[model samples]
Target: MPSMFGRTTKKLVKEIGDQELRPVKCLVSATKIRRFSLIQRKKARSRFWQLPDVPLDVSLMHILEPGSSVPDAAVEVSADFSDTEVMKQQAAGSVNAGAEAGFSEETAVCRGSSLEYQIVSTPHETWTELQKRKLPDPEPYFLKQCREAGVNLYVVTETVELRNSPVLQDHSSMNISGKFSIPLNIFVKGEGQGGGLKVREKKLTVPKGSVVAYKRKQLVFKEKDWGIHHIAEDDDQETFPAGRVQKALGLGADFKLLQEEVSQKVKAAELSKDMQNIVFSNLLAMLGDREALQDLMDKLEQEPFGHLDGPGGTILTELQKDSCYSGVVSKCLILYLLETLMVLSDIQHVLLAQSMEKRILLPQRDLVRSILEPNFNCSENTPFTLQPELLAPLQGEALAITYGLLDECGLKMELNSPRSTWDPEAKEPLCALYGALSVLSQLAEA
Candidate 1:
């Protein structure tokens, strides 16, 4: 009896994590010999066991399913002991001949405890069987058992504590009192048993002008929907949380504050008169806020001239530095801002009473208009060799920015003139610029 206990305990300890349980030894009589059998008492319990203290690593048990044609699987058993004493005990089982030997006595000896297992080598056909049987769904049974066994299931670590909390007492009564539970789903990596699921943080690259759909915590883009979502730079690179656009866009919690702030500012004109004029008149120029827009801008402003400019500033500075597309797009945005200020100035002239006009209104309008339309070419300037390649896309973003500003200023743009190809279809300039920067950043990376 002592030898049997030692062998069984040794075998049980060796088969961990793989959700496997193997029978290696059993009790026997002088007249008949019967080997021990490892049976699954719970429908979906694991066939492997975990022993953090053991050096050989996680173990599993393999057994042939009932009605299968294959030979009984090689029951791979193990134990916690460094020596072979336990293995020797498990192998000393009684014989089973043509007689039902007194079963009550043997049952009593093995009644109070059961072996732990991890499913190591599943039958090849088991997946089909599992589809039908659904026997090893880890969520309810196998994971629960591991939790009972004192393994932190979801968090993978190099070292962990392992314990076999008793399900039944030595006297054969249920011992339900002192057990603890795991907090989350146990995560595993690599192979079978409790070793193939993982929670990892991943980064994916997105291309410019692509329409991404959020679903199941992943960003998805269908081939046909690309051009519908207007992006200014169409080449900007952007990063967001994995899946669900709302989450990736930071639309939750404090991020939702953006809408609130925007609403409050637009609703109440608390700013000084000059600030209000500047905000609305040059709204197209401020297609983005300095502080909040920095999030989208940060990605583009990396390396070389990163310290000098953010995304919006970088676009402006780079256009000035490079001779691409004659800096047409950059010029377009600047010109739009200038024209917008001129229009606002004309409006101020109309609104001014003669007495207040010369003292306050006219000088401020002159200063703003001059600043927006700086005379660069009137002086001696180097002629730039422009590249035609970037003209169209840059032109698109510039136009988008203009449209956004007009909307922000609550002003109507006249598109009837030859120079005015301003598309009314373009929405708010700030939003367009946001989209454009996102697109362009993605393009820059590509």
Candidate 2:
């Protein structure tokens, strides 16, 4: 039974081998195969993948035909061929792109070639040749014509001579000799006056110890005479009073000392005595000297308001005839002191340091605004009204103080509605507001 099974297996294997070796039938026509091969060849010859050096093989074309029996091998070869063509197209595209970019760059560089070359190379030889060329000297004929026209064609040279004078003489003499050279006209071919070559000599003898005096006439105009008159000069000369040297007090001087000095100046026979006294007194009151300031305030409060002369005949009473005088004086005093403190660097430091310990009461915001307001009546000189005469100078002082303080402190505070509270947090800003208001007030007055 085993021998029979072996023989059957051998016969089945031989049959299977015969079936596997059988040939396949072609479905596509020869025309289609020829057309497909022609298309592929045309594509291969196109500009995208041109290969003129390598010719297509007839045998390979024939194998690539559609109706060929070896479909698997043909399909694989066509795939590889398509891949190679795609790779060639990509390489050609990259090469063209690179060439275009390079061409553009080269074109740009060539555009300004002349200018770029000139800038890079030095023209030292050309410059040297230009420097070597000398300008021709002026022609004699031109000079002759200039002299004939009275144009003065001569160069004047001066020489200084130092000589010792006789000791018995009252004065010394300095001899200054000048030489004038008149060039002869070479173009005219002659010399002398007719040829425009002429020389003139001049000598001046200034006598030593000689005194010349002339009476100086005064240019005066009389009411009777319409024209100006030259009258005899008057011997009297008008003299102006000297200004106060506030700097003598020094920036670091004590507040009391400054007050005393200011008081002394105010009491002295000086111009604007009343104004000076009021201004200084107000300044003293503002320096945070509570005891002194309070005493003054109490005295002012005790005085009769309406009458010019009260029981004590106080300064406040004298000023109180004008209702605005008290407020204005106080305001001006504060402004003045603020300015003085700002001007003195040392004093500013002291004030800033002391500000931390003793905070001074600031004037009411409304009162400050009223004084600083532009439209407020400056023309009125009636009782209780601000004197128009004093307004301008007070305003100027205020503005100056404001500027100085702002510059020194470098503080930017709102001026329109300043914080009037005397709290530590508000002190610096309050001071800054005072300055800003002063500036604004001056502007309004202007």
Candidate 3:
């Protein structure tokens, strides 16, 4: 396998103050929370950033015992936290949660003297701790006790990891035998913090209101709930084949007959009229003609930028700066091809990992409906035919690393037949059309 990680390893952030503020077992009603995605404007006026404060429901399932841990008294609060009095007022309410614990309504209702009021609230300086975490639905007895004691349960809205934070390394309690697994950034924006663990240092108390804002914090890493359940099922199961994958998606193809077929279709306008089809056809044309790749590169490099305050400018900048694919024609062509496919397919991310069986697997299948889902004219007999030395890197660890490009997008390629008959719902051929879309993207960085 090629040497891993040529770039300097990114440092984990440490200056974040409220990196730990969060929840354990929490309930998030999807219909209850509002999203702030107005940034992606549907039209001219829709792009306005002046969005009104939206309402969301967040209930905490765990809180520190009256004396279990100290409250935040001196940490810098994250500016992203919404503390408008109006928002709190809209959500504010005192409920005698302990009073409704009994099975009999009469017994609970008559407990007038024993009824105690407790308010719902958020905790500062604590990320949702997933260690020793319970289910989303907290036990009734446990919740009642917390209520009667005037403890407030925090519902985590987001969990940010302060990379390289001294708090994580200095504390052994953060993780033990994988029990307190480092909390992944699972609770997404606008949703209630779901099942997780929130921890406060055993000895130190975090100050209130102080939280980490967007800039100083790292937004890398996330948890997976799909394609992973089968990771442990079979040791010898057929995982994704590296030899075929890189060629089919990352490595450019020898269009040949497929190229001619696509050309004829394009000329006749038999192809879909969508922009995706035009782009995909252009890619097929590139793969077939060596001169086309060079011509495309020339155009991109020669394209003038009036002012790069636009969308494609950043991409052009990144493309020019990337020296990794500089000398290799195939690598350069594959990078652009796969990137265009990602946009056309609307597949923001692809999560593939090495399974226990020494095979590749897709762990997250959400958001991967590539529009180029119908154009793999290649056959099962001819996917690749390169020198073994060239092909060697596309197998084993290097191949795994390449698929990771879909996750981290360092970006590469080859040609191979996709098992069109493979499972359609993310297994096997993953829709040979979608697979060929002409295909893949991956993980965020710290």
TM-scores, in order shown?
0.15, 0.16, 0.19
lDDT of 3 by residue, 1-31 (tens): 1111111001112222333322111111112
What are the per-residue Cα lDDT tens digits for candidate 1 across 1-446? 12333233334435333222222221111111112111111111111111111111121112112333433343332222222211111111112222222211111122233423222232334323322322232233443453333222111011111123223212211111111121111121111112112223222222221111100011112221111112121111112112332212222223123234333323332333433333233322333243323322232223332333433454445444634444443333333222222222122222222212122222322221222122211222222221223222212223223322333323332211112222222212222222222222222221
**RMSD (Cα, Å) of model 2:** 54.6
lDDT of 2 by residue, 1-446 (tens): 01121222223224334322111111111112211111111111011111111111221223221332322211110000000001110011111111121110000000000000000111334323322333223323432332232221111011011121111111112221222121111111111221122222222222221111111211111221111112322212111112331222222433234324334322332224454455344433344432333234334433243222322234454455444644444434433334323323333333332322222212222233333333222333222333333323322123223323333332231111122222222223333334423322222221
Tell me how candidate 3 scores on lDDT.
Answer: 0.24
- The lDDT of each candidate is 0.24, 0.25, 0.24
Ranking of models by TM-score: 3, 2, 1
| Residue range with the least summed lDDT across 10 consecutive positions in model 1 | 211-220
User: Which of 1 and 3 is ahead in TM-score?
Assistant: 3
Off by over 4 Å in 3: 1-166, 170-306, 309-311, 314-393, 403-446
**Candidate 2: misplaced stretches above 4 Å?**
1-273, 285-288, 301-317, 320-446
> Model 1, residue 4: displacement in angstroms?
92
